[model samples]
Target chain A: MVTNEDAARLITAIKTSSTYDFTDYSDKSFCRRIEKILLDNNMDLNQLIHKIGKDKDFLEQMVKDITVNTTELFRNPEMWQTLRYHILPKFKKNRSIFIWHAGCSSGQEIYSMLILLNELGMFDQAKVFATDINTDMLEAAKAGQYKYRFNLGYLDNFDKVIKENPFNFEDKVDVPYEKYFDIDKVKDTIQMKPFLREKAVFRKHDLVKDGNVFYSKFDLIFCRNVIIYFNNKLQSRVIDMFNSSLNRDGYLILGSHESILGASANNFERSKGFYKKKQM
Target chain B: MNDYKAIMIGGSAGSFQVVSRIIAALPANYPLPILMCLHRLKHIRSGFVEALSIKSKLPIIEPHDKEPLKAGRIYLAPANYHMYIELGNRFSLSTEDVVNHSRPSIDLSFFSASYNFKKKLVGIILSGANKDGALGLKSVTDNGGLTIVQDPKECQVPTMTTASMNATKVDYVFSTKQIIDFLLKLA
Candidate 1:
């Protein structure tokens, strides 16, 4: 039950004590995350603040815990469907397709993208880059292992996006899960196949502070379900960064419900299910 | 009552028609922003806002993430997301795991609104089958905000109201008509 004042105190402590800056995060959700942290650790605000000030390792863990890492393969099948059928086909002309998954939580999205790209026969030409503020998440993204039973539901989503053609329902492809992942029911693990795992270059990058790490512009940027944690000011700043990082006529695919707003909205034109960078 | 910044309503199950009636009674120029976190089918995203807007004078919207909160508008929690009202009076949507088996969780919404608005908030619990809003309404009470529940006898499903009454010392337990009349007085 951390109050707003208490959350402010913790934020200030983190800012002064570490390089991690949560100042511009959406306060309500951030505060709720802090509350959850305290409850999980069974510690009060004062003790948590003390730990944050003194222990660097503890602070890193806190940052990882605070950043919501919930994601799944083909989480929104409809968005993936649009990407598979409409968006990726446009990039067929490009010799190299550069895809960036900003905030690639637990790597499900990275695998989802790779699976789509591979199915389209564009895997060889695609350069995939993934970045997250949490190093633990980056490591998890690298490992590419998820709980089998926990993610069984998302397998249906994979089938929806990869197998079933919505435009032509009768035209279905029998794509086996073994092609992309090795599901071990005995071990309760769904390990992503090495080909899909190796495609993404996982890196530690902060969306709030870190500007475009890749000097080269991208064909598409996926920053799904990540910007929702940010306040309007921060969202605009990140959106502006995405605008500059994208190549002309490139796409910026946000989460299903996410939309670019404020001044940054001018840079993107809403395409089928994505925000396309307007040719300036 | 005029000093209240926003009104948060939490409902589930047999609460939609009651909510429709209540919002229909609010004026076009209603001074307070109404935040409704009704439990909805996670996949059906579009029609809820349209259905709610049919009889309401104010524009009903499923606010985009980080959209600024405004007066005279009805903000419904988007499907498959938890909506939070931030300290700076802006909407923040989250796709975190669902709470109480609901994505647009009533408890989570009320928790944020209560924290953000503090004593200047008004929280009302309508007819529901679940106990999600009980803890949230209690949060409003704990934060010194006004708390109301639809009179359980008048509710289609009394579990939510009954749970809310047990959760905290609610300020009022009003019937649908009384609740609407009370909100009208605020305007």
Candidate 2:
């Protein structure tokens, strides 16, 4: 029911009421989050305009609500399998491989990559730069403890990836998946291996505002699922940022369902699930 | 279901055949966006969409995060995530935790659609082993949306349909063939 005029008005109201500027964020997802807040609070648009001015807590909650910091370990195992067999091994040839897991939700993908690298016996040479805009999620990622059960299917994907004959080298290295986790008997959840947790460094950075991450080009950058919460313009901008951020021939892994369509498709050469920035 | 913007139908175990039946009946230019969530294996991604599209006339898409919801198309909730509707008629997916042990959860999508679409939602719950969509169908009714539950007698698994009937007063109860016929009228 919201029109462009209403969205512009809401943006004005939010900017006037709070210090944060949401004008650059995707309007579609932004409106949805606002609508959710309206529904949860049982308030209409007019009431929302008034409440944001009068109530500070509502403004704070709205920021947290809009930032989607939800992800699972190996969320899409096929993507991770690509990382395991195809991507990570390519990076292994380098003495010290650097990775940036932009918008790493709860460090699931980070840990997944680390475990894969560990299995390949190259984890010691890799450093994972995992960061998020949300501090709460960043802390969770740093903690590297998960309450959810590590699904057996996640392990199954690892096995399938090992069997895929990675790098076409003909020799496949096998590792037991259970060794990566230390069972928490009381909580009934799994905490990732301590050795892997030490390798991932978590930080807080907004993908929209942060111009450069770490000021060093990375061998591989994972910006999966993160770009989908954006409009075409923002998506293109982020993809360009990622393209520049990667070293030549470096890979960019997106979500399984996400593709670099339209203008963004030109930034990288597609190889099925993998997108490699062209060597200039 | 007057002036309906979207049609949401969700199901679980034993629901594939029912979903295929509905899709086979929908024409190429069905007016409203049809979103579906069927419980599936978490790791298997590619085959399901291809399987669903085999007999469907409408172009079936597994929505990327924040993809705009469009008319005359069908959207499937992808694996290992719960798809939600934003007020502006776009899709948002979250992977907080699996609900009712099912990602791409039926209830999560239904409840969100109920809130977003409100009076414009047509919610349907079909054959399944669990009670995932029961409360969601209730939410559809609460928000003045239409609710349909497959007849338990005709369901491959009746736990979900029976639970849905027990949860709230639904607007319609029909067999698979009758459900297809009803959807045909809307198309």
Candidate 3:
């Protein structure tokens, strides 16, 4: 239903006014999301573009909606298992570890990583950079308040992964639900304790338009389950960015369903669920 | 009954009870592969397979990538991946993006079923919070496939089933229990 003309107009309007560039994303996916956006707002293509050109907040929301931010803490247990067993142990030898949980939605996965590091005794040595395009989600991540019910699953997953690890395993790291949360009697909320709060620095970063925010390199990056929304071209570009962002032997973890196929596959080696940086 | 050797059901939000009842009523010897495309939060470990496994006589498994489709088994889409059926009885998985804000989107599975199985496909839209399966049900019907929808009055979240009922001329609209009974008869 999206004609070439509609695509061109939308691209041009976004490029001229907005900070993000979605021109290179897959046309089919972009158009589909755009149509849904229009429907949601009850606007036709021209009307939507007119609002996008004039309203910054509207444009920001559109970008967030279009980017596909559905993610979970410890999504695909196998990938987390891979990270704990094969990847993090290698990083233990480093002086300090820098991890970018890119496109981290609501910081659940970042917290999951922090929990993993805490269990491994790497919490003191690791600094996590959690970024997403959604400012609201980033703010929620900063607040670190979540419903107790949601945390229960991640806690269980973390416990299972840590206790089951074959190398340098420990059964003593008891991350009971009560340890990480303070039960608030007034509002019935579970506020995350200060210890889990200190590890992550949350920021708003758009993968498509904003240039790399990091001045230096990272030891590990988790960009899970985000690229499939992109067209092949955008996926490659993001992969290239991830490759460039990492130090030598740095790790890039993707979604379980995703692959570093075609051009990107040559840039890294599959090390468990992570793609370890190879010599360029 | 012709080309579709399987049926794929997709729903979200208010789908759990509906899906459970539907699967529960199917006969033990049902011959079609019933693929589920329920939307689950990416973090929660899904017990959908186990939840339905005990209720149904058929085998239920979380489908793996490239797992070949076998008749009479039920495959639930793993959380965070879009489950698609291929032409040669193979399954393809995609993390490509969320359609209708869902990864294991009902629309994606239904549309894929429409294209891949055409007239042989039987797409069902059940109780859900969103309009995901409406267009997809239309696609299936347009492609000469049979389409069924849960009656809106009987659904926990009727918006989605209502949308499908309004959007397309579905073959049948029944209560979840009746729909399951019908599937058993068809099988």
Candidate 3 vs. true structure, TM-score? 0.69
Worst 10 residues of 1 chain B by lDDT: B40-49
DockQ for every model comes to: 0.71, 0.28, 0.14
Candidates arranged by lDDT, highest first: 1, 2, 3
Over the stretch A225-246, how does candidate 1's per-residue lDDT look in tens digits? 9998987789999999998999
Every candidate's lDDT: 0.89, 0.79, 0.76
User: TM-score of B chain for each model?
Assistant: 0.97, 0.97, 0.93
Q: Model 3, B1-187: lDDT tens per residue?
A: 4646678787877788888777778777888889888888766755666777878888887765445788888888887677766556656566556778887788877876776787888888888899988998998898898888888887788889888878889898887777767787776
Candidate with best DockQ: 1
- Please write out the lDDT profile of model 3 over residues A168-231, one tens digit for every residue: 4564454575665576656645676788877688788878866569777898988876665555
lDDT of 1 at A107: 92
Residue A233 Cα positional deviation in candidate 1, in Å, after optimal superposition: 2.7
- For all candidates in order, state the fraction of native interface contacts they contain: 0.88, 0.33, 0.09
Best by lDDT: 1
